[model samples]
Target: MNKVAIITGGGSGIGQATALRLAEEKVNIVVVDVNEKGGNETVELVKKLGVDSIFVKADVSKQEEVKNYVKKAVEKFKKVDYFFNNAGISGSGKFYLDTSLEEIDQIVGINLMGALYGARYVAECMLKSGGGSIVNTASSAGVIGQDSVVTYSATKHGIIGLTKSLVAEYAKDGLRVNAIAPGPTETPMVREFYAANPEMKENATGGIPQKRLGTPEEVAELVTFLLTSKAQYINGEVVRIDGGFTNTK
Candidate 1:
């Protein structure tokens, strides 16, 4: 049987790239996102690769919607071999004291809680199906400190914690849980930030040791490996994909 994967945020960025990459490997993809147009587009791309694909519209913050995503994936594919809990938002990118509670709540709800929801639901399904792997989309902000993005950093840190906890909870059941922390990635969220403050982009890129932004495909490659047998021993870890940005000055 072909392996099956359910990817949240499969509408764009790392999630979208991962969907196509996995499909090319003969894995069935369930692309879940709140954006119907982008989600459908991703499914179409996956289908073009000659693999089965379905688009699931879900707001990861809503338990009912999140549950529905898992239900559909199970009903249609019978089992889940992999899960990419990649849905997230950049929050308001504000300072700690200056940031409002509303922005903090929004960031926590989507970035942190959204991932937990997917992890809990997908891990259970994987247990029933024998075993599987799960990758959470965290940020380099999770590993290191960032003065400007207080709430965003906090939420990503929470994701890292979730990844480790779930790995412990499910490892004995043949389930693997891990997280990828990417630094200065080239995604829609990054593009929007650069467009709004062009100078900030230059400063941010210059700070990185690579002196450039990472691509979604580059990050997706690492995540794809984590979900494969080659990485069966890997779990409860946050792999950094930041091109030395976090390690270097």
Candidate 2:
């Protein structure tokens, strides 16, 4: 059977990489993003890989938009077999006390609430279809206390909780939920964040055992495995692909 996947944040970085990786396996894709250009670009790329694909432009922080993306995926593909609840944003890297309410709201709105909305709506579709898998994007900050990312860390930690708790409620019903906690990944989001905080880039690299940031391709590989039957028994796990960044901490 041809698998179907809905990837939020699919316009770039890890979400884009995972969409392409899954497309290679002939999986139909629904690329969801607020950026129309990037989302359509991903759809074209997936088509070149010879798989059915479509783009749904959406701002995931809004519950209605999140539901619409899921609806569009089902309308296009008939069923959603995998969901990458990966849309998120990092704050201005200010100290928690120094951060503004607007920044806090934006971070929580996209990172935490967005993931929650995606999982709720997507899981409903999966349950109706009899089964499915979901992969959420967490961060090393989610697992361990990190400096200068208090709000981002809070949201990710919530992601880990969301993953395990969802499995606790739905695993027996053929639903699988897992999260990935990546560290200092080399993506546009991270690049922009690091560029704004030049000292952070050097500090992060110095702390990482690998001495370099991870690539989206690497995270995509891990996502592909967890979303497929190869990881049937790996439900509710938060696998960290942080190059030992969290290991030493």
Candidate 3:
């Protein structure tokens, strides 16, 4: 039987790249995102790779939608071998004091609450099937700290806690939960963030020892390995893929 994965935010960026990468291994995919066009595009790409895939348009912030996506994945694929709980927003690049309450709610709703809802339901299903793996998208800000992105940082930090705690509770039950903290990866979301905060981009690249933003494909490689049985011994770890960006600080 082929493995199956459900990638939230699979419409673009790291999620999209990971979907394609896993599809290359013949894993059936369930692409979940709010953007129908991008989600369909990912499905098409996966299909061209000769793997069965489907798109589930959902607002991960809402628990019902999160549950529906898990239900749909189970209905279509019978089991979820892996889950990329990667849907999130970067919030307006405003100073913490200047950031609005609305922005904080929006970031927390989607980035933090959405991840928890997805993991809650997906873990239940995985527990039923004996075992599964999950990778949550954390950020460089999640590990250390940055000037801006307070709300975004909080959510990503919450993600790291979620990853570790889930494994702490469920490792014996055959669940492996891990997180990836990437440093300014080149993704559509990151591009939009940089476009809004251009100066920060130069600062970020300059700060990284590699002097360049990481690529979605590079992050996808790490995610794929963690999601597969090859990483069976790995659990509850937050692996940093930030080209020495966090090392200096």
Question: In order, what is each prediction's RMSD in angstroms?
Answer: 1.1, 0.6, 0.5
Give TM-scores for every candidate, taking all chains together and pairing residue i with residue i.
0.97, 0.99, 0.99
TM-score of predicted structure 1: 0.97
List where candidate 3 sits over 4 angstroms from the true fold: none
Q: Cα deviation of 243 in candidate 3 (Å)?
A: 0.8
- Tell me how far candidate 3 lies from the true structure as C-alpha RMSD in angstroms: 0.5
**lDDT of model number 2:** 0.95
Task: Candidate 2: give the clashing pairs.
Answer: none
lDDT of 1 by residue, 1-249 (tens): 899999999999888999999988999999999999999999999999999999999999888899999999999998899999999988555568987988888888888889888888888888986889999988988998887788889889999999898877778988899899999899998898678767767877888888889999999899999998889898888999987888874
Model 3, range 1-249, lDDT digits (tens) per residue? 899999999999999999999999999999999999999999999999999999999999999999999999999999999999999999889999999999999999999999999999999999998989999999889999888999999999999999999988999999999999999999999999999999999999999999999999999999999999989999999999999999999
Q: Lowest lDDT 10-mer window, candidate 1?
A: 90-99
lDDT of each candidate versus the true structure: 0.89, 0.95, 0.96
Evaluation by TM-score, superior candidate among 1 and 3? 3
